[model samples]
Target: MLNCHDATFLLSQRLERDLSVTERANLRLHVTICRGCTNFERQLPTLGKAARAFASHDPGAEDSSS
Candidate 1:
C-alpha cells in the first residue's frame, strides 16, 4: 500500500532507471488504484522526451557522461 508521495517519487525514478522487482510491484499496485499517479506515469515519457529535445537545442549545455 504505497501512498501518493512514495508512488510519485518511484514514478520519476522509473523513468530514469530500472526498478527492482519490489519497486515495480509496488508501483504497479499503487498506479492501479490511484488515478492521479496513473496519469503521471503515463505522462513521464513525454516529459522526458521534451527535456531531451530542449537540452539538445541548448548550445551551452555540457554532456556529463564523458
Candidate 2:
C-alpha cells in the first residue's frame, strides 16, 4: 500500500515519465481507495491541459494584443 505522499509523488511523476507495471498498479489502487488522491488524479488531465495552454502563450503574443 502506498502512503498519500508516495501516491501523490508517483501521480506527478507519471506525467513526466513512464511508470512500471507495479507502480501503475499501486497508484491505481491507492487512488481508488483514497478520495483525495482520486480527485487529484482526476484533475491531472485538466492541470496538464492548463499547463500546455500556458506554455503555448507567448509574451510577444500578449504584447501584440495591447
* Predicted structure with the largest TM-score when compared to the true one: 2
lDDT tens digits by residue: candidate 2, 1-66:
999999999999998899999999999999989999998888989999999999998879668757
> Model 1: residues >4 Å from true position, as ranges?
59-66
Clashes of each: 0, 0
lDDT of 1 at 38: 90
- Taking the tens digit of each residue's C-alpha lDDT, what string does model 1 give over 1-66? 899999999999876799999999998999999999999888888988998898789554566555
TM-score of 2: 0.72
* Runs of candidate 2 exceeding 4 Å displacement: none
- In model 2, the number of clashes is 0
